[model samples]
Target: MKQDSFSGRATQGSFFEGLFVRSLQASGPFAEELRACGYDPHHPKAIYPIEVWNAALEVAWRRCYTGWTREAAYREMGRQLALGFLQTWMGKVVDMGLTMLGPDRLMARIPSLLALDTFRYELKVQPLGPHQYRVSIRNDPDAKPELIAGLLEAGLGRTGVKPTATVVMHREQDFDIDVTW
Candidate 1:
């Protein structure tokens, strides 16, 4: 895959970038590292390099949490991302829809929602039961399953269910996520 194949749309990047900058300004403890990544968070909606996005995330993790592992950072980032999403108008709409539908129904709509996003992969969601689901993504070798798992769990939480997600890698560029509540 090309290095920038996973690059996301500028609007998506802006959402994360804005939150990152605001967090840093609010004493996130990784301002310098994030700045050194060289992508201006203040850029209006425009295509951004995926490398910079991932690098910013790494910098935040390393500089902000001195003793944490990458996995721990990812988990926390995911939680923060979920909360951040709720702060935006679009996010609020999605959150309200998800809450109204509840977790199971929301899981069923995940693939379609992902499709509308700028993620560079094909997504498939399958329901195993009322409280179990399987989500598979293809052609995304660099997929951050931890972040995604956090997002899934957080989304389910909004619907009053405690959810757990287990990710399994299969060959190259394939991820299978098993979710249960």
Candidate 2:
């Protein structure tokens, strides 16, 4: 089978899939469907085909949140994922760093973290002004602006800054996020 546009390393995919499944399980329903989609939350380093993962997310979201739009659900999932990350050892380190250095410095570290995480896309961080930034993602066909926005918002929130993220551009190849606090 042809792979989907969005693919990540086994470790990255496992982390996300585990978080997604656990979040769904906590809310009740759709956990079985997620597993049926070929993801096992118990295995944290297994490889997942992005196509199956995407389909599973869609199915789980549709079943669990019949009234919510995909964008909204994804945004909320992203937010929860950010919170979930904070619960991990690396996430605790990141949280401590963000708390100490504040959002601007934290923003500067995002690209490195993303690279370390082995995400499918490349991240570029540009400063617009004090307390403002333009974040660009390249080679992202899935257009995950909501997820990016949510993560940024949560990161900023950690630094005691209420952030506002605007999707300046969202296309098949790239996306631009304008973040201000």
Candidate 3:
């Protein structure tokens, strides 16, 4: 079996569990599907496979976000995660520091930022313009591009950039997101 790679406070028994049920409610109806999957947000595992994480998102997409396109629903769920991040003291402190960097710099910092939560991935940001960037994720084809877009939209929005992030490429274990303010 492949080694599990995804981590960070969200995957481990930390901030994510606290915000998960609440985030589910905020994003849509309660996530009864999660419980059915043996994922009790209140007493979550210290670690689980990324496939389970994907399944949880799939549950949210199908059950909670009815009538929405798959990508749209994933994006909305990502935004909810960002909102949850902000409710934490650590996240609040991080946001205060992030506020100084604004969107452009923040986009470039994707790799380092993600390292705090995920692993076994390489992300690069190339500037297409002073206010535009192309973020490429390699080495983990299972990465969710649209969900990343939603995270960017919410995080960059905090800088008042009104940013837009679109998945422009996907081939095997690589994808790119084009981001602009």
What is candidate 2's lDDT per residue for 1-181, written digit by digit as tens? 3243355432356345435644554333465565566555554434455566566657756886689988787777667667777766667777787888788888898787653243567789999999999999998655678767877887778988999988899878798999999
Comparing 2 and 3 on TM-score, the stronger one: 3
Top lDDT model: 3
**Clash number for model 3?**
2
lDDT of 1 by residue, 36-148 (tens): 56455444234445665677678777766569888777766776777676666667787778778988888988877653245558889988887999999888746777767
lDDT of 3 by residue, 63-142 (tens): 77899999899888777777676666557876886789977778767777654244567888899988899989898746
RMSD to the hidden true structure, all candidates: 3.9, 3.3, 4.0
TM-score of each: 0.80, 0.81, 0.81
* Model 2 residue 114 CA deviation in Å: 3.1
User: Which 10 successive residues of model 3 have the least lDDT summed?
Assistant: 1-10
lDDT of 1: 0.67
Question: Which residue ranges in model 1 land beyond 4 Å of their true spot?
Answer: 1-11, 17-29, 41-47, 115-119, 170-172
**What would you estimate as the lDDT of candidate 2?**
0.68
Model 3 TM-score, 2 decimals:
0.81
lDDT score of residue 74 within candidate 2: 71
